[model samples]
Target chain A: MKTFKLGGVHPPENKLSQSAAIEVLPLPETVTIPLSQHLGVPANPVVKKGDSVKAGQLIAKGEAFISANIHSSVSGTVQKIDDVVDTSGYRKKAIVIKVEGDIWEDGIDLSKDLVKDISLSPQEIVSRVNEKGIVGMGGATFPSHVKLMVPQGKTADVLIINGVECEPYLTSDHRLMLEKAEEMLVGIQIQMKALNVDRAIIGVENNKPDAIDHLMKLIPEYPGISVEPLKVKYPQGGEKQLIKALVNREVPSGKLPIEVGCVVHNVGTSFAVYEAVQKNKPLVERVVTVTGKGVKEPSNFVARIGTPIANLIEAAGGIPENTGKVINGGPMMGKALSDINAPVTKGTSGILLFPQAETSRKPVHNCIRCGRCASICPMGLEPYLLAVLASHKRFDDCETEKVMDCIECGSCLYICPSGRPLLDQIRVGKNETGKMIRLRNR
Target chain B: MNEITLISVISLGSLGTIAAIILYMVAQKFKVIEDPRIDIVADKLPGANCGGCGLAGCRALAEEIVKKESLEGMSCPPGGNEVMGEIAKVLGLEAKEQDPTIAVVRCSGSRENAPPKVKYEGDMTCAFAHNLFAGEGGCPKGCLSYGDCVASCDFDAMYMDHKTGLPVIKDNCVSCGACVKACPRSIIEIRKRGKKDRRIFVSCINVEKGGVARKNCQVACIGCGKCVKECKFDAITLENNLAYIDFNKCTLCRKCPPVCPTNAIHELNFPPRRQRPETKAEPAEA
Candidate 1:
């Protein structure tokens, strides 16, 4: 099995929800759909209070080239357009709607029939993906259409499909691959056509033998695609890592994967693309994994974009008695939610509820020249040195050391025996260094 | 043996004299004529090198002062008027009197006022926490209470009060503005130390909509304009669902605090209020 060359770690798999089928969560009472769900500038809201909207209706329009359109996940009456607390615990502009009935917009084909034919031209497909607001559903909600439109002078010769759901306890992608293999394969072919690529590879970690087996069996039917099982690594699902693992191409520092003639998309994104292109569906719902040691029933639910996290917890057998913290995503790179009522966005992959004993961080100790952090950093940067410099506010040194190259995989922090807050300080340094570079460029 | 020793001493002495002559000539050729007053001015400074004067250090500030030959746009925050007066005396220039100032935390989102909605884990620095989420109190603009400001203080003028979960500035604070810069949310402000060390200003910085801000913090300034209307000195301005009081224009009338519906206006070091007969009579009527 192939893996990224530089550095990686093996965390506990903790795939508790792997057996749970994706259940369709009932519509929430009120869905607070935030406008800024994806990377880049937030979409401008088009509807106001007292306006009636149907499911799959365009509620906000993405004006910027890099943004994604926002659609209503449920048919409802717009209660108000105001700032509501989001997954980040910060107030952001969102459209609050009161659930009325299950009314979907026209032109949407709501059926279970599989359409294996690709009808639209490549250009038309890209615009159609953008119109549907299909973003990468593997925790980084980057607009998929932007990825499809290869930049000038960059030729994409291969499309890499990331099926390595490496984050512990996150099985949304795994379950999606197992259940919707045909749809995802079709989506992969659609993406390959859109990117003008002749070959595509689906990279899955070796731990998920079933997913690899399923995808391998289906790839022969879908020409120009294959499955490559990879060594189980923490961040194998990262774009660069997955590319390096499958195609032996390392995306250069501070550059996108397309620079290496590759475009990476998540399995969930491929399924979403299939739904959007074949069934005329917009991206409104996603599979979210709700799992933890303390959870009564670790399950995966196909939840709407604006469903409150509290509702998901209730469906997964209410909050555990000893639930200490509720993280919005996976354990390695997720943020703890300050408000349980904060609505889900496109980027949310899993909701992990840790017990109180595991929630508290270990006591920090002085560095004893262990070099474990540097040894385990997936980006091959010195995490301990960067953390020290960041704590001391030496941003110039941090920038010179290539702080921007950090993928924030938390492997360094995970491997550190002294329990140093390596990733936290590195994040601060990256933010400050990025700001300094931007100011200098301006 | 005596003759050899004599020859060795004479040769060594001559080489030393020649080397000394060359060194003296080189020094004279590349001499830097520095003004003597720079040293004197630097000596008069507090030597904290806190960079509160917007310069590199005391030495840089001294060089600037002596080079400009005027203290018009230069002032050392750590070394207040006394040190400046001493430097002025040494330079034979008149000293400018400047108002004394101190660091004041603007947010009143204490533990009791705005309790933590969620527990925070990971690095405790406010900078990291600020980048991660709004805050434990769910106020994006409120104080995070992680004490980055306290950690940045060089003079031990700040400490985090556990009861209030806010950094308390001491009297020794020279208004050096280190805490002001250390705050990620810009919750600490350098305000004028008023007469008898009394000051009045709004203690909340939340700019969310009135209902939203109040839901997170009980003492958030809702931009109700009550303080703006009550201020006779035109000191308060309401904008962006928050109220700000201009310290320069404030006359310490103490009228705005009573009219504030949320008690967001904080009066510091002021005398206790006298009991009003109307409040006592209300209970009797009831």
Candidate 2:
């Protein structure tokens, strides 16, 4: 059971939705598809108000090299293209569509049969993935096509598929691996072919024995692919951490996995790739786990993109009367959604609701120089020092201290006995430091 | 024993004299000749070192003033015009008289104006909260009310009014502009204090559409242009569903406030208006 060499914590594995089978959520009446779901510059809207769109139609095109395209999830008439409040509580341009019926664009195979043949050339596969708007579906929502390109002079020798759904209470990836293991293997092969890699490894945490067992059984059929079960650790799903765990390769600071001749993709991303390259489907829907302590029935729903989170909550037995906070993802790294009406984008993996009593944070206490934050930081940066420097506006010092290396996994904030807001301050520091660095570069 | 003691004392005294002479020679060799006027200018400064003048500190400004040999672009905000005049007199240069300004919070989303729509429970610093969500009041551009401005004030001129959940600037603000820079939402501005320290400006910064802005805040400027149309001096400009008043052009006409439907225009330190018969009659008719 290999794990990353650096620090990690074992948060309570609140896998409440682990046993819940993935259920396809019904079509929402209207969907608000934001243009900037994936990281990087927002996609440019190609459709306008009153334009009738099919389910797989490209509504927004990723014009920038690093951006991802956006496709409509349902066949509908575009109600309006306007700024709507997103999960960040800030308004962003979104295309609101009134869903009419279950209609999909031409050429998308709406079949249940699995296609395993890798017929398309590697270059065609990459372009197809780009055209389909496939992105890393494990919360980051990075454009998958960009990752598949493999920058010049960098040779990708190995591919790592992240199946370690390490975040407590998030079982979307776990369910995907268990239910869609065969299709995911084909997806892994497609990604391997795109990167021209010979070997691929699927790293699943030991806790999900069923997923691990399921992948191991199916992996033999797909040559050059292996399943490696990792030690259960928080943040094991991080790309760098997963690479380090599976292949003993440490992605250097300020560098991508390609720097180490590796490329990591989430398990959900592999499944999405399978559908895109094989089934001719665009990345318009994903499995989102909705669970919490107060939830009546924690369940996993294969929901369409741009569906309002309120609909998902309603599917998970409705919002409890005592619900205090509803987070957009996992507890450690998720953002609290200010508006329940905010739509689920490609990145939303889970919705966690907390009771009123558990919503309030612990009272902040003075730092006792305990160095617990330093010990638990997986990036090996001193969070306490960064927090102090950031609070005092010492952004230059924060940069020198490598605040950019922080993964923001919330392990230090979780382990700190003094209840210091280490991660929050570090986030501020990282933001300021990044700005300073960008300015200096410019 | 007396002869030995005398010899030791004489040797020690000679060593001390030699060391003192060498120290004096070294000091002379590495001496920096600073103008004495810098000291006078520094003395005239309030020594707040608040960086309100965009200089490092009082000493830095003093050095700059003496080096520049003019008061051309140097004015100590905390010390105001009096200190600049004193420095100019000492330097035998004319000082430029400038209008005194004070920090005014442009947001009027008080507790009553914009009630909290969501509960914020994480870090209380406005910088952190601003990045985390829009705000408790659900206005993305309104004041966060976490007192970052209050914490940045060095003159003890700003304090958070718990009743309104807004920072109240005191008379001794000195127009240092620290609060203006401290605000994460850019809700505070340095404006010229009008006659009798009275001022009129739009208080809301929300740029959401009229209905959307009103949904989050009662006093949000809807960019209706009513105030812009009412202003005789062209002081008001409406853009992005928000209104801004140029203090330099405003003449205290007191016309825009009455015309503003949302009451987003705020008048500070002004005497109560005389009740008009039309206003009284409207209430009676209603």
Model 1: how large is the Cα RMSD against the reference?
A: 3.4
Give DockQ: model 1. 0.75
Worst 10 residues of 2 chain B by lDDT: B277-286
Among these predicted structures, which one has the highest DockQ?
1
Q: Each candidate's DockQ score against the native complex?
A: 0.75, 0.69
The number of residue pairs in model 1 that clash at the backbone is: 0
Candidate 1 per-residue lDDT over residues A145-206, each given as its tens digit: 99999999989999999999999999999999999999999999999999999899998888
A202: Cα error in model 1, Å: 0.3
Please list the residue runs of candidate 2 whose C-alpha ends up more than 4 Å from where it truly belongs after superposition.
B1-31, B276-286
Task: For candidate 1, please provide the TM-score of chain A on its own.
Answer: 0.99
User: For candidate 2, what is the DockQ-based docking class?
Assistant: medium
For all candidates, what are the clash counts? 0, 0
Candidate 2 to truth, TM: 0.95
Candidate 1 wrongly placed segments (more than 4 Å): B1-24, B92-94, B276-286
* CA RMSD per model (angstroms): 3.4, 3.3
